[model samples]
Target: MAATSRPKLLAGRKVLLLADFQFEDLELMYPKMRLEEEGAEVSVMGAHPAGIKYTGKYGYPVKSDLCVDNMSTTDAVASYDALLIPGGFAPDYMRRNQAMLDLTVAMADAGRVVASICHGPWMLCSARRTDGSPLAKGIRATCFSACKDDLINAGAQRWWTASSCRAGGPFITARTPADLTPFLHAIIDEMAK
Candidate 1:
């Protein structure tokens, strides 16, 4: 009998995940695990200082490997193949930092994978490219129903899709926690590419 093969589709790929206070527990954890299973290295960065623990809305906790402030160098940022932003109140807090927004824009401008789930899309709506263009502008997107208006106001085009819609760059988004499976799969697919 033939042995089953395990897929390490994202072997050698590095992914950066952004989180802060009140991140969605499942949104951050699910991707970290799933992506690792596929052989991707995932780094969690907090909007605050490094080494501090951040709690999710449901009270789950995650330690920050580094602060977003430390990802300043071109080489440091360039090492990542993709970025993941998990939803929750975290987006509301993370979105306030210029570094977080700049990082999002840089990842998108490079056409790398930029994925956000649920309220995570708030970062997408807030990021601005070097050209002064809104990151959400002219992109097909979907998010939590409450955020629908925010995206629209930010110039994002609405798309009804089961999984995710392409962002202003090589972006993807899911509407809620229920969509984590599909959202995680979308991130894997893009990173795999």
Candidate 2:
């Protein structure tokens, strides 16, 4: 049999993985590698610029290539094709940063792909529409069970706690680390479409 030819499905695409200290290791690393495997340029952006390192919940360390502060300019956040928000205590901290919240809100308003998992929805809950409505309003989403009330209170139309993943509009969300595969596959499927 002849070897099969594979397409670089994400060729030329740019993805930004947002996180900070205490981010879930698997959720962050897996998607980063898989996105790269599909030929996308993946950059990790944090609260600080390049050279600042953040430790994951499990002690994994990743350096940020860009900071949310630098993303104040339109081009900084608008240039990316998608944004990936991994779960953990990181989202708790990330949501408190005005710049981070602005970036998330900008990406959502732009209708860009935003893939988040587990506690990742925390950041989503913190985002708001230009009209000042919660961004999660009427959006189908899934996240860690602990976040269900927060999601609903923030206005998620349907938040699935037991499901592996849910994709609605430009948002793709998953419940936990175990759901990472389908979570990312859902994202790849979205990008392909």
Candidate 3:
């Protein structure tokens, strides 16, 4: 029998990427490109408005096409199939923004796919469910070693140090820049389903 070809994994799906100043360059760009390659439409969303530009940790500038604060319509979170939070010092600042937290909570509560790497879980911890629960409370996750304490305190039950990536439910997390490959693959796998 002739083998049937498979369609693009994430065709017709939309993904939202959240970030702020000092985002890790590779973590954000790599997955964005990969997602596009798999036929997913990816939008870069920041803490501010569309005109705002965020510089990456290595000096790359990424301008936002969508902003958390600009999402006033009720269907904002419903428009995307998944949310990706790239790591770096950006997460530290992102976690402090009420609008950003609200967006994350909406995504998590809607059961949309969420992926975080390095320091990205900082936002996840802060912007959990709408009832103010921490998304990591009982989820297995991995982030930069420095974030272990905060992640646990924020309620991650098991913080994996030996693994580069962990996926629980609709959430996926990676340890560091070295794990970006597996991290993207995990997100792709999630979206494929």
Pick the TM-score winner: 2
The sequence of per-residue lDDT tens digits that candidate 2 reaches over residues 1-193 is 9988799899988898997999999999999999999999999999877779889999999889988887663775558888899999999999999888888888877778989999999888898767888778888999999989889999897648547899988899999999988998998888877
Stretches of candidate 2 off by over 4 Å are: 1-5
Output the worst ten-in-a-row residue range by lDDT, candidate 1. Answer: 160-169
Better of 1 and 2 by TM-score: 2
Q: How close is candidate 3 to the true structure, as a TM-score?
A: 0.92
Off by over 4 Å in 1: 1-5, 160-169
lDDT of 1 by residue, 1-193 (tens): 9989887999999989998988989999998998988999888998778889998889999998988887773654579999899888889988898988988888888778889888888898889877777788888888887888888888888673434544435878888878887777778877777
Error in Å for residue 184 of model 2: 0.7
Query: What are the per-model C-alpha RMSD values against the true structure?
Result: 2.2, 1.7, 3.0
How many steric clashes does model 2 contain?
A: 0
> What tens-digit string does per-residue lDDT give for candidate 3 at 73-102?
247666999989999999999999888777
TM-score of each: 0.92, 0.94, 0.92
Question: How does model 2 score by TM-score?
Answer: 0.94
Best candidate, lDDT-wise? 2
Q: Model 2 — which ten-residue stretch has the worst lDDT? A: 70-79
Candidate 3 backbone collisions, by pair:
none
